[model samples]
Target chain A: MTAASDAPQVRIDGLQYCNWSREIFREMRQGGLTAVHATVGYHEGFRETVRHLVDWRTRFRDNEDLILLARDSGDIERARATNRTAIFLGLQNPMPIEDDIGLIEMLFDLGIRFMQLTYNNQSLLGCGWMEKEDSGVTRMGREAIAEMNRLGMIIDLSHAGERTALEAISLSQRPVVISHANPRWLCDSNRNVSRTVLQALRQQQGLLGLSLYPLHLPNGSDTTLRQFGEMAAEAAQIMGAEHLGIGSDLCQGQPDSVVRWMREGRWTRQAQAAASFPPQPSWFGSNLDFPKVSEGLRSAGFGEAETSFVLGAAWHRFITVSLPSAV
Target chain B: MTAASDAPQVRIDGLQYCNWSREIFREMRQGGLTAVHATVGYHEGFRETVRHLVDWRTRFRDNEDLILLARDSGDIERARATNRTAIFLGLQNPMPIEDDIGLIEMLFDLGIRFMQLTYNNQSLLGCGWMEKEDSGVTRMGREAIAEMNRLGMIIDLSHAGERTALEAISLSQRPVVISHANPRWLCDSNRNVSRTVLQALRQQQGLLGLSLYPLHLPNGSDTTLRQFGEMAAEAAQIMGAEHLGIGSDLCQGQPDSVVRWMREGRWTRQAQAAASFPPQPSWFGSNLDFPKVSEGLRSAGFGEAETSFVLGAAWHRFITVSLPSAV
Candidate 1:
């Protein structure tokens, strides 16, 4: 093995739910990605959610040379040693559990590491960011938080409402995370986090994974790396530098239907006009653009170690701390 | 209407999970049943459980002359006025909620009244009687009990483990029910309630619906009406006569596959030997056997007023007090 390949790498994309293919696996490898938390559930119930795991099993088998399914931080280290990307499964919503708290462990047993309480609508646990009246964390939500904490499964509040996120952060014994979202000050979208949330998140020592999704950018598809870096710097100022990382929120090859489903999953009958996936920022369209993010962070005044932390080191440490020791 | 028809008939079967058909609906009418708690879920998840409601909707439409779906005490009165049987949907297992405690409200909205915490093995909420070790009510179980109480959904502990049943009774604010189980003193099956559960259930002002399922009978398929009556009298001595009713778990016309599914619901692949439905006792075979139970109770030295309570009045009063007012 080459000396470069022998060195320990800690590069990780905190979150991604791309349309998987051999091509994307190749792109991940080419980008030198050490790990990626892949989304598996949005509006699915237990059985449908299990189907997603089954689908990933085939993908792992088919792309055995490129990726490994990760259960814990050790798997990420193993992926680095084997020169393959470690894939950590996550749910973008609690829909897969479908109101039963028992299914959480079943999903965890299946290798899911991260789970969001909501996905842009009212869920059983809590109101999503898009809900009109945020009811905050619900009775079920409290129970779910306790169970997730006990299991050492990370809680992601990226699409949760303000109060729900705050309540969860306060309630959780372990640090929670905003797996993929930019600051609301950077982009006025409901999907983005608020200054108050960032402060609370920082207090809990949680990580804020800055998003590269065009809609979460200030200038949308036209957002430049310099502007993105400036936003990162501001976020780092609010949430400590160590609590920042890249969660690309990349939807590399998914069609418009997937995005539409994400927005209007069985909640309404009215079809949204012109439904489609927003164009990603030019600098970060696919997995092969990790270098661009690093360059942007450095150009925005991040030190070598700080830039490295934002790129993946922070996520690696957060994940290591969040997961159960035996796992 | 004649005085007989105008009277507020409260002849309710606390539980039944028959292979529902128009013929069965006619039999229920023939039996002069005022209401029936029909089991709609056993090992189903959210969507599949909803499908049961959908099926019941169709059944209601098809048999409008015979049955009406009951949402509350008022609906039972409506069914009595219309000379039809009110069908109150219930879940034999919490599997319908799967792992999401939020689904409890969704099921309630769809007209489910009673939900047991476990079926017959280790569940997320607690242990079933079949489980080797009883872990009692789980974290999710406590949350579920609170939500159920808030929504006015009756908590049923028929098939739960001893500890789980006791924990649920202690935890629930409202009166819980053992919708279908005989006293263990009579049958000695894991499915039967213990003296401890009966005493606790009575203290909470809960009702124990004496079951007519053959397996729960002292002599199984050959159990005589006199024997059944004696068991009810013994149960009444321990539990006040007002805390008893009929929950004949009459699985009329169902194939052996249904029983197999109930016993080994994807929990084991050993494929239980000779899996089949047990034969019903000669005294109670179908919905048309309500009069036989009344006769049995009367022969067992129950006074006319107390016999009426066991026949259905107690269930009516308990259900009226259990359900949410608006519902």
Candidate 2:
């Protein structure tokens, strides 16, 4: 019980955040989320790249009451000290960094803790999880790994292609993160990481976050938060407790525009990449209004301890070990 | 004929763009734009705020056979040098700089020429075009003005609120760009500029770009491209030739995800801000791409020279003088 208040329920990896608005924070609070592994970069668009970290730092520095900017192990203690949730700034697509090696460290300097290699399609690092053909991580991908390792930035392979992700797992000196993903073996979805990859993720000492996209589930739109948690539980069964987290990818408070942008129908460039991947079904609504994930975990018969671990503790350990206090 | 080949035509004021692949370049080509002032930022969500610029510079350097990155007035020559369209990298949201005034120069060092104050809602500078109530410019906004002025980055007031924009124009030594905006007096759109402000813009020697958003027209989606052009022509009449430029505001070829992310409705905190703006009646597809701006100008009986000037020459003049050469 004492520990339950101290850390995130599960790791809660791969929270697909867009902008850090007060509205989003309100949604998080109302949804009953204390913390999230936030994606700072884009599934599409610009200006949000490195800016995500800056805003978090500003929020952390300016308002120490509700949010904590976690850079070191101490920040977690500080989070518990203030009852503020921790935000691990994640780059969903390396396209934010473009091709610069130096920026990896600079971003870490600005408090970017987690970095996803790709999302949905191709980036300089490698093909995305959704790509029809994942040729594996590219030469740039290898370099990115070295740069990330040096910068104390965690290499998150959440939205990465299978071959590329495998190569990245093998290449990365530090443990990586599949921050927001599902098990392909349980119910095959290109967006989900394969069981073999999940196994590799576990073996590599990395973490696998079960995502909450309806398309990734067997029943999809009808899938409840409990089913969503089950997907994580299945992956946990395969990857083990230490390596599993749940990424809500909760865009609940986001507008239809945000959903449209993700859907790739006709709203944004996501449309351009649709040819390379299967179109996501326009599911029920934006991120299941927050607490549903916890309800799902509870309904899934997850204990408070398990839910706590699943909710946030998983990310706490993952980030602590993945991104050291060196920065 | 010479002017037609050399002038900056259709000076697009605003489009929330990110680090695009070659596919975007092809789209621009298909759009038939002779010159484009595009943006680089995380308005959606990607990574590397400044690295986005470096990536494009490299792409332009390698693909000089096709694209050109314009910095200062010279790159326009270079674009003309290789018969490629000149690209002025604009920062849509100052979020890319992350409280660093110096980074403005660093980005300018990498070929950033234009900078917008904010995106949709608010930033350090003040309220965005979409904020219900404007906060005017902030103290930091003052510092930004000096930095941008010192660096010769033209102040873009497209997404800025009325008070902040007027303040920005007044505070700056040079003329700012209200790039890709319509006249609010004409259609009462949030994204559109007011007619009273237009008078002030002329007095301040600022450039006013006629934006193209169907929602900002008097007619709904039923409005034709010709109607959109007429609005521009009307703004041009008010602002005069030297102060006029073609700001296409084309969201075409963008992703559905981008559209989703921007609109604040149903799922988002700020989605329905523009709901009252009234979209124009549906057109017969889009007979108006960027090239249509030129053709529209011609059909309106604008002389070939003036048409060319409206397309590119006006933008060239605005940018050439707006930015400092040595700073």
Instruction: Return the number of clashes found in candidate 1.
Output: 6
lDDT of 2 by residue, B1-327 (tens): 797555544333334243355755665655544467776653522235545644665677676666676666666655654556667777777776667665565566556678888877788777787778887888888898888887788888887888888888788887888877778877877778888778888888888777656665656566566766676677778787667876655554555555555554233555453343333234422213456666666666667767656766777777677655532
**Model 2 spans > 4 angstroms off:** A1-327, B1-23, B30-32, B42-47, B54-62, B263-288, B325-327
Segments in model 1 whose C-alpha atoms lie over 4 Å from true places: A1-327, B1-8
Per model, the share of native interface contacts recovered reads 0.00, 0.00
After TM-score superposition, the amount by which residue A101's alpha carbon in candidate 1 deviates from its true location, in angstroms, is 29
Error of 2 at B189 (Å): 1.3
- lDDT by residue (A77-138, candidate 2, tens digit) is 65555566556666777765656665665466556777778776777888886668888888
Candidates' lDDT values, in order?
Answer: 0.87, 0.66
Angstrom error at residue A217, model 1: 23
Best by lDDT: 1
